[model samples]
Target chain A: MGQYIHLIFPLVIGWGFAFAVIALSHFLGPKKNLKTDLTPYECGVEVVDLPSSKNRFDIRFYLVAILFLVFDLEVIFLFPFAYIFKSVATVSPFLMIEMGVFIAILLVGLFYVWKKDVLIW
Target chain B: MFGWIYIALCSLLVMFAILMVSARRPISSAVFLVLTLIGIGVLYLMMNAPLVATLQWLVYAGAIMVLFVFVVMLFQLRELNPTSISTHPGRFALLLLLGGGFLGLCLKGVIVGLQEQPVIMMGQTLVTGEASLKDFSLLLFSKHVFAFELLSVVLLATLVGAILLARRKQRVS
Candidate 1:
C-alpha cells in the first residue's frame, strides 16, 4: 500500500499542476465578444457550419492512419531482432529474407495506393 | 497527507478523462487527453517503471496522439453548441450506484491486501544495475519469435486493407 502510495504521489502533483495551468489560462484569457470571434476559421475560409458538428474528412486522413499503424507495428519487429543480433549474426541471411518479404508486401500496398491516387495531395 | 495527495491526483485524472470523452470540441478533447496520458505516465514513473513511463509518452503522446490531432486538424471541427443534460433520473441513479459499488469493492480489496503486504524499498532493486538493451532485444527475438512474426503479418494485412478501403472508385463516364 505504501509502495502504491509513493507511485501515485508524483502523478497527483503533475495533474494538479496541469489543472492549475488550464484554469489560469481560462481565467486570464481575453473574453471579447465579436461575430468574427464566434465564426469558425478553416484555412482562412469562413466555416459554413458550427465547429462541433460531424464534418467530412478527406480520404487522406484514413490513408495516413493506416500507414501509421502498418509502420508502427513493423517497427516492433526490430526490438527482438536488435536484442539477439550479436549471437545470431550467422542467421543473418534468413532474417534478411523474412524482412524482405515483409517490406515487399508493404511496397505492394503503397503501389496500389499510388495507382488509385490516394497518395496525391 | 501523502495518501490524500494521491487521492486528489487520481480524482483529477478521472475528471480530465471524463472531460476528454465528453468535450464537443475535438481539439479541446485532444488537449485533455494529452493531460490524461501525462498524468498516467507520471503514475508509472512513481511506480519505478521509468522505462514503461518513457514508452507511454513516446508511443501514446508523441506518436499515436499526433495522428489523432492531425486527423482532427484535417477535419477542422468547429465549436459545438451546448445541449441539455440527460433527463433520465432513474438511469443516472443506477449508474451512480453501480459506480459507487465498484469503488467500494476496490477500496475494500486494497485495504485487505495492505494489511498483509509490507512496503519495501521501491527503487533499490532497479538501482543496483540497469539491464542492458541487448538483453531485452535478445529476449524479444528468441523467446517471443512467434509474436514478432505475427505482428509483421498483421501489419502487412492492415497496409493492404487500408489502401483498398481508401481507394477512390473510378467512375466510367
Candidate 2:
C-alpha cells in the first residue's frame, strides 16, 4: 500500500494541472469566432482534402489494425515472461525452451500473415 | 482519502461506460471506451496491483482501443452516414435489463468483498522489489503453461481467420 500511496499524489497533480489549463483556456481565451478559422486547414500548404468525417477510408486499414492487435497482444505476453525468466532460468533450465516454443508459434503466425500478402500495402 | 478516491474513480468508470454505449458517433464511443478502460487501470493502481494497471492501460486502452478506432474508421469506407442508435422500445427494455443486471452484480461483488476482505491471490506482498509481475510470471510459466501455449495457437487461428475475412470481399469482386 505504501508503494501505491505515492502514486496518488502524482495522479492528483497531473489531473489538477490538466483541468486548470483547460479551465483557464475556457475562461480567458478569446471567444470571437471567424468562419475562416472554423474551416479545416491542410497543413498550411496545398489543400488536398483534409481528413474529416466525409472522406472515405480503406478496408485494408481494418485488416492492418487487426494484425496490429494480434501482435501487440503477443508483445504484451512477453512482458511477464521477461519479468521472471531469470528467476525461472535458475530453477529450471527448461524454461527457455518453453519461451522459445511460445515465440516460435507466434513466428509461424507472422509468417502466415506475410504470406497472405497483407503486409504489402 | 483513498476510499474516496477509489469511489470517485469507480463512479467515473460507470459514467464513461454509459457514455461509450450511448454516444452518437462511433469514434466518440470508442474514445469513451478508452476512458473507461483507463479508469479501470486507475482502479487497479489503487489496489496496489501496478502490473495489472499498467497492462490494463498498455494493452487494453492503448492497443485494443487503437484497433477499435481503426475498425470504426473502416466502417466509413462503405457508408458515410453515422450508425443509427437503437430506437425500439424492446431495445430500451433490453438495455435497462442488462444495465440493472450488471449493477446488481457489481453491488453484490462490492458487498461480498467488503464482508470477506480482498483475497490475496499469492505473493507475500512484495514491498521492496517487483510486485505482481514476478508472482504472475511464476504462475504463468509454471501452473498455466499449457494455457499460455494455447493462447498462441488461438492467436494463430485468429490471424488466419482475419486474413480470410478481409480477403473474402476482394475475391467476390
Candidate 3:
C-alpha cells in the first residue's frame, strides 16, 4: 500500500489541472447576458424540428456497442498473457499455442461478422 | 491511514450504489453505476493489484459503462415514473429473504475466518508484484488454458448472437 501511495500524486495533479483550467475559463472568458445567445440553437437560426427525447435509436448503434464491449474484453484477457509471455514461454512449449488458439477462436467471430456485412456501416 | 482511506472509499461506493438504484432517470443511474465501478477499481488498487485495478477501470468503468449508457439511450425512457415499476409484494418478500440469507452466510464466513487465523496472507504479504502476476499467468496458461480458450469461444458466441439479432434483413432478389 505504501509503495502505491505515489500513484495518488498523479490523481491530485490531474484533478488540480482540470479545476484550474475550468476556473480560468470561467473567470477570463468574456460574458454577455443576451437572451438571443441563451437560445438552444444559436447562429441567428430559429430552432428547427427538435428531435424528441422519446425517439428510439437504431439497433445498429447497440450492435456496434456490443461488438466494442466484446473486443474490449478480449484486450483485457490478452493483457495478462502478454505480461508473463517471456517467463511462461521458457517454462512451457505450449504457451504460444494457447494464445494462438484463444485469438483464433475470436478471429472466427470477426470473420463471421465481416461476412455478414456487420462492419460495413 | 490506508484503513481510513479504505473506509472512506467504501462509504463513497455505497452512496453511489444507492444513488444508482434509486435515481429517477436511467441515464443518471448509469452514471452513478460508473462512479461505483470506479470506486471498486480504486479498492482493487488499494489491494496492491495494479493489473487487476487497471483491468477493472478499463473493462468495467470504461467499456462496460459505455455499453450500459448505450443501452439506456437505446430505449425511449426519458421520464421514469416511480409508480410505473410493478411491484409484487410476495416476490419482493421472497427476494428479500433470499438476499438476507446470502448476506448472513457471507458474514458468518467472515466471522469464522477471523476467529480461525488460517495460513493466509492478510495485510502486507498481500502485496501483488510482478512475481505474483507471473504465477497467475503461468497457471492461466498452463492449468487454465482450456478455460481461457473457452472464454474466446464464449466471446465469439456473443458476437455472432449480436449480429444475428441486430443485422438488417435483406429482401429476396
TM-score of chain A of each: 0.59, 0.72, 0.79
True-vs-predicted CA distance for residue A95, candidate 2, Å: 1.0
TM-score of 1: 0.57
- On a 0 to 1 DockQ scale, where is model 2? 0.49
Q: Residue-wise lDDT of candidate 3 within B1-173, one digit each (tens)? A: 34445655665576667667767788988999999898798898877777788888998989988988988877856756663322334544554554455455546655665666554423465544777777777787778877888889899989988887886778213
Shift of residue A111 alpha carbon in model 3, Å: 0.2
lDDT value for candidate 3?
A: 0.76
Give me the TM-scores of chain B across the candidates.
0.63, 0.68, 0.71
Once superposed on the true structure, which residue ranges of model 2 sit more than 4 Å away at CA?
A: A3-36, A42-55, B77-131, B168-173
Question: What are the Cα lDDT values of the candidates?
Answer: 0.65, 0.75, 0.76
Name model 3 segments beyond 4 Å from true. A28-30, A42-44, A50-56, B74-76, B82-128, B171-173
The better-scoring model by DockQ among 1 and 2 is: 2
Clashing pairs in 3: none
lDDT of 3 by residue, A5-94 (tens): 577799899999999999999999899879877778755688665567346477778888999999999988888889888766787768
Per-prediction DockQ comes to 0.34, 0.49, 0.47
Candidate 1 lDDT by residue in tens digits, A1-121: 2344475689799999999999999999999988877877787777757555556667777677767756765665555465455567775665555556666766776676666666667
Against the hidden reference, what TM-scores do the models get? 0.57, 0.70, 0.78
At residue A57, what lDDT does model 3 achieve? Answer: 70
Clashing pairs in 1: A51-B78, A51-B79, A52-B78, A52-B79, A80-B141, A83-B137, A83-B138
